[model samples]
Target: MWFVKVHQNVKFHARETTALRTWVPGLGGAGPRLVAADPALLAVVVTAVEGRPLHGAVLTGAEEEAVFRSLGVLAGRIHAGPPSPSPTAVAPVTRADRYAKVDRHLEAARPHLAPGDEEHVRAVVEQAVVLEPLPLVVTHGDFQIRNILLAAGGSLRVVDFERSAPQPVVRDLVRLPDHFDGREDLRRAFFDGYGRLFTALEQAHLATEAVLDAVSGIGYGTAHGDPELVERGRRILARSRAGTLCPAPTPPAGGNPS
Candidate 1:
């Protein structure tokens, strides 16, 4: 079976193609096999795999935990190998460069936020920008449940590569905190499956990444008429405001937070 994906944006097409060609090799057949690509037309044909996306599925507690754990393992596999080179550069893999992304999305999202929430978002971004650097990995970019597919035998296949890129490892974790919705058991199961704990730096970096994820979601959702995405973005911001996602910045050493 085969599927053809036609992209509207040239960059998305480049990203999807470069990521599929370079990084998919190490994914061990868990990702679509790129069959053909047409750069001029901004389309690619990939072999289709069978399964429904994991989102919106109703499952028992045990089933949910098992699914999340399996997702964690799959994510680990995507991040396991050495970084691969891209023919077309995505964003530069640096903290400063990533902050620019916040600026871009925040500009679009500001109007949609509740009056004072913008201030809180900015404050969180400022603190996050200064944290020690995190290790980089080839991340799945949009690592949410909607992109995960579950087969009949319970095998999972991760799809969608248009957003894939090398970024701070925590970049991939941006959505899971909200997805877990304060459920420590599911979170624990996921990390256990992933086989490692978050570093101090990655832990600290997540809130800022969450900021980026939220703003982009709100902005894109609003423009595209996706109320669901807008609501999810608001939910993430709410968690940040409540100090669960983004908390007050600790004073730096003996210096103030500037």
Candidate 2:
């Protein structure tokens, strides 16, 4: 068995165990399989895919469209799966839990934020707690480009569901664009595919709000200490507040479009 140790065990063991069981079976491939409860460590053992990471390499117009369409279809399938029952349930993390985590990080990085930005960040955090909640569904807790693996036969397998939990469908959607720095067209393709599976407005709304929650969380995480993360967070929060975040038209090259 070929061993590819990607990184140290950053996520918890139990969480890693749950993710492998939940996601590995659903992936398509011949050999690189997930090791079952390996005593050595909690990591997936899948036949490695052939494509390079989607970063730095801008997708050509056609490839970009294709990528988005493929992602949309895959995400729809994942979301369509029924939620696990309560005893074996993947519960959605509450806003309070999220806020508290962010609060701690912000306190640690107090000196880094500009005075005005600090106040804005506080307000964003407060508003996040009051947003309406979404119906729980199976969410890929960390669905981003880095986690998606594109294989030789055009097969795209999503990896690292360590954070997979019962979350709103929108939460899953929100992570898709983050890997691409908020690609609006890609987001549309994803939503279009998602729409085919979940046609109801209520379902879409639930997903949308869940995505917003994710955006808020990302903002909180980025703004905690890193300057680049802070800027990225500000952009996400601003676009979200203006109703231009999810399923909305793509913004202009470098500015938020209301």
Candidate 3:
């Protein structure tokens, strides 16, 4: 059967289509198959995968580790693959481009931030922006566990492509801090499945990304009356200030799996 999606914005429509067309092949049946797309109508039809959101699901430690590992494999497969052949494919992102995005988010967050908070945020971001550029990959944009689906047979599926784009590999980890914060075993299991580890530079970049995410989350949540999200954002920002948002990067374990 087909699942129809109607996008309110043309850009989101395009990103979703381009991502599905360009990277679904690498997912190995873990992602939806695009059936048809109409740019003018801002809609697309895709083959539906049956499952429920994985968030809040009760599972043993072994089961959870397996889920995270499988997710890592899926993420690695798509990130290592090439982008779309279509001319309309999403453009690769550079560090400068990412910094610009952070700037934009910073502006939105400034009004919500307390006095001096914005400057502190800028200082932290500046340090990260000076790092060397990382290899770009097809990132899911929002890689939190809530976006994943668990099938009856225990297989995992990823849904939603509107936010997909070519970005630094660590960009996908921005939303994952909550999961791996104090869980080294799970983190190891995940990278084991992905066949690589975050280098020191990538770890620093991930921390930077998380800071931006937190500020943006605070701004958006406050504007939209989402206290829970705002609280979560504050917690993340506190961690960032404490220099604990992400673990210190370790030596490279290996290269990305082909």
Candidate 4:
């Protein structure tokens, strides 16, 4: 069975897919085997992944934990791999790049928000913009549950690498929200699977990044009349401000953060 992904008139998407055909194999089966890319038709053919999306299951407690761990391990491996060429190949997402994204989207999101939400978003962006650059990796760019597919026996593969890039792995890690009811286990399991202890401040910076994504979603939802998406984005921003998912455990002075 073959999976055919057609980009139609989306030149950018076509090119990104073409590039991903070359990149994913280096990850050792983390992604589908790219069969062929038809640039003229703006399409790609790949071996079909015969599995259900991880999101489509009512997983047991242990199964859920295993999935989260798999996510972390997958993330760790992707971070170790090289970047994909989207518009163009770049080093990594710099703080300036992230700040610019905030500047562009925060205004678009302001009209959809409650009082001071815009300022709150900006403050979060500011905090992240001032921190030292984290280590760079080939981030999956969008590591959401929907992007992951789990085959029988818990084997998994991630799809949609068009947005992958060289950026802070936290950019992907922040995909796991801590505020969802009964999601603490998922969060810890992800980190444990990642096998790298992150500093509290780093996690906080990622929280800030997540808010920026929410702000962008809010703007889209408002323009598209999707109240559910708007509400979801609003909830994420609100929880972030309330410190629901933004952890900043203070480290001792002059001591290395784990």
Candidate 5:
């Protein structure tokens, strides 16, 4: 059992124990025994695992591919599971909600944006709003390196599902390639695995925007009263407008049509 001290009134012990009980069965893990819980503090006792996090920037070519493969398979399993009956009752954040939050941030920063950049942001926002909604599935609300734990023998585990909730299956896919920018090879591996479980244009669209929205949020958040990240977001938005940023279908062997 491991004890983690957290902010006041935020206890991880009970929740971790409960989560382990609810989610760890048949996974070859013992129940997480809660050692303590306090209303005025936050902490949890969990079965500690010995391993370092898989960082995108530090991974070798092969390692990177492996990580993407793992992510894809894991995401498929999670999404295929039954939907959370009461998603809204949980700490769920929808794509629209995230988009709106980012929009508000962009609006507040409009005074600092270049004219072209401002228009680009507006376009992306509009496009996102017009996309059709896909069927909701369980999502790992936050699926980033910091939350994925890599173990020996190529086995892995997903930690920190506090934000988990029912969302479009595509929402889960978006986290993959976006997390590793410019790595098309790794992206393909992830997509290949994802394709085995899910095959549909609508699902692909949901995943596509989820990634764009995530990237947009990153760029916008980094701007945070600054102009640099906002400028980056503008460029990304423009790319999206040109049809270059949307997820592309695998081209035929001869090559894609102009």
Candidate 6:
């Protein structure tokens, strides 16, 4: 089956298809198998992932902890693997490089942003730029909740490798649902699987990533006439300024997010 992704930019489609074709062989069961990519059609064809997106999956209670633990182990294993060897491979990005990307997107969205929010972007950039460099890993550029799929036998299959690239593991870490601070059990299980300790600085780093993610979304939405995405971007910026984007998310009864 084909998992086609249509985008406003053909380059992005081509890039993603190329990434998938080059990387899927090494991804094993963690991702889909690439079949073919036609830049002319702006489409990618991959073997079907017979699974459900994690966002609507029935992972709760003990199952939630188990899934997250497996997720952590999955992340650790992938990050430990070698980077892709593509002719057009996107190299690892630096903290300053990420800040640059954020600036570019935020600037493009300036007209859509409130004057106060624009100012907040500037201030946040100043603080975010001082970050030190970290080691690089092959990142699933968009590893958020939606991209994950629970396959047969409760195995995980991550989709959408179009944005995959070499970047800091922190960039990869940003997408996992480890932010709800009060839910220490899930957090503990996730990190425990990855064999990592949730650190103060990495937790702090997420706020800046959230801001940039918002600005990037806003810029794309403004250009593409996606009002919902634009509105969401604005909301994220508002939260960033108010110090709420990464605030301890209210824990649910089951204490799970994906």
Global lDDT of model 4: 0.71
The TM-score ranking, best first, is 1, 3, 4, 6, 2, 5
The lDDT per prediction is 0.79, 0.54, 0.78, 0.71, 0.54, 0.69
Q: Evaluated with TM-score, which candidate comes out highest?
A: 1
Give the per-residue lDDT digits (tens) of candidate 5, residues 1-258. Answer: 484545332323333333444443323421133345454555554556545576434767887778777777777766665555332244344656767666666555565555565566555656667676666766665666666777776656666644556667666554444443566677666755554533445544644455355345545655566444455455455555454554553532454222
When 5 and 6 are scored with lDDT, the better candidate is 6
RMSD of 2: 6.3
Predict model 2's lDDT versus the native: 0.54
lDDT value for model 5:
0.54
In the order shown, the candidates' Cα RMSDs to the true structure are 5.9, 6.3, 3.1, 4.1, 5.5, 5.2
Poorest 10 consecutive residues of model 6 by lDDT?
249-258
Better of 4 and 6 by lDDT: 4
RMSD of 1: 5.9
Question: Can you write out model 4's per-residue Cα lDDT over 176-250, one digit (the tens) per residue?
Answer: 673333576666666667766577667767787778878887887888887766886888888887777656433
RMSD of 4: 4.1
Off by over 4 Å in 4: 8-11, 83-91, 178-182, 225-228, 248-257
Expressed as tens digits, the lDDT of each residue in 156-252 for candidate 6 is 8888776667776667665343333345677667766777653445556766776777788789989999876688678778777777556443334
- Determine the backbone clash count of candidate 1: 0
Enumerate clash totals for all models, in the order shown: 0, 5, 0, 0, 7, 0
TM-score of each: 0.89, 0.69, 0.87, 0.83, 0.68, 0.74
TM-score of candidate 1 against the unseen true structure: 0.89
